[model samples]
Target: MDEVSKNNVIDFDKEINLLRSRECFNETGFLLLRGIITQEKIKKLRSRLEIIFDGSSRLSASIFDFVAEDNFLSLVSNEKINRVLKQLLGKSLRIYPNLTARKATFSPWHVDDAFSGNKVVNNESNSQFIQVSMFLQDNHYKYGGGIDVIPKSHLEETWQIQEQSLSESLEIFRRVRNKSVNIDSVAGDVVIWDGRLLHRSSPKLTEGGVDKYSLMWTVSSIQSNHKEFLTHLENRGKLKESIENRLYDARYQELTHIKRSDFSNFFLEKIKKLDINLTLKDSS
Candidate 1:
């Protein structure tokens, strides 16, 4: 597909206006856009991801690394998504560089803000931010581990659970009587939801399990000026101390074994092939 043809920008103003009128968002706090990404692009990205996954020493390490990597970042910052974000959040949209990849296991019901140390504003009349995710593969209902959202749940008052009671969060899943939508999306389907939405991954019912690959990006309006330092701390705290320690311990080992310069050259070549205009000049 031609670059121009591939860049399918959605009308954000119309979408937002429609969402405001519909109680669907207020009731579920989430919305899905099926097949937002093109099939060809998805195939190319998935192929690159498979190669990266095979070579990476620590697949479960800091999610930020994956977000920062050129292959992933390019897809997340696609022109279509950027256009929508510019309309929704204005010109100065800052993307949080953390891409979460949930493997075979079910995630407990929780708000994105739960891990952030900052308190959630209890205002349904206003929107602070929106979270967008692109699925890299199909997450069928039978295969499971797909995201299950409680619509408009974000409008409710915020509640806190003690750190020790984290396991109890799973109970919310049982109460999800509403028909849960499985995001059995093709490689390029994009899903966007309000940041305050209550969502969790459904259990991966299949015995062998599936790798649920997804990239998440957060878009905040320039006015919000949300704090980032505290957010990072909260994310760090969510990981087990032992796992965090091991990741740190293995970081240097992985870096030493791989030639940073060679990786840089590879990315530079790939960027040239993609014909992307990089604002910052590469010193190398």
Candidate 2:
């Protein structure tokens, strides 16, 4: 992959318009943005994540909630990301806890929003929901193990295999596995895609290859009518005091001097559900 030139600064306003255009999402369910996170930033985030993941069994879980590491949260609340999100979603957008840590390895074919038992479609041609994931390492198709998606899968009203039995679904997954393309990307590149897309992780073919690391943030358009889904997105607050403090500090800085207590109060809503087992102790 060609490295993004250091001098190649992006015009975010223009980029935002292109992303919000119907033609872009119609052809591909995903958008790839290069140089969103810098190499130095990626290194810092990797170090923090290593400390958090060290000797922990949480990696086995599909989603680790409330990962309040400062470096990671800083990336999530990046100004550039917020700008794009504001264009996609309205200004009334509310971010979840700064530390929601999602780690995955070898994901089978699935949809992100479908996990909540809701089927999303662009019936109104409005941005219902989106997920932005920042890659912490380089990924390539030829080497195996990267994100793969069926183009325009989100435009479908329903997923046929979703209603089938496990055995039947697995057979269908096998058939469509080769039809998808591996979304290869470099470290610090953020890939934003509609949550309705049929996507999954490609298996790592090389022996002893390192597992991919990514940080993800999910946001919903304020105009979306999915109340139950939006309610679930707003659910938060099971983090330890130490973790919560880190989250508060990171968010405060990101928003530039927002009150810590107010920030904490804003995020501390009734817990609808805890996605993963919170058995790990605060390393801080």
TM-score of each: 0.65, 0.66
- 10 residues in a row with least lDDT, candidate 2: 275-284
Residues 143-262, model 2: lDDT tens digits: 443466776666754454432455765775776665676666677777677777777665566655555677766665545544444333333222222353422322212322222333
TM-score of 1: 0.65
* Candidate 1 lDDT for residue 130: 71
lDDT of 1 at 233: 30
Stretches off by above 4 angstroms in model 1 are 1-27, 55-68, 100-105, 114-125, 161-167, 228-284
Over the full model, what C-alpha lDDT does candidate 1 score relative to the true structure?
Answer: 0.50
Candidate 1 lDDT for residue 273:
52
Q: For this target, which candidate reaches the highest TM-score against the unseen true structure?
A: 2
Q: What TM-score would candidate 2 get against the native?
A: 0.66
Clashes of 1: 7
The positional error of residue 140 in candidate 2, measured at the CA in angstroms, is 3.2
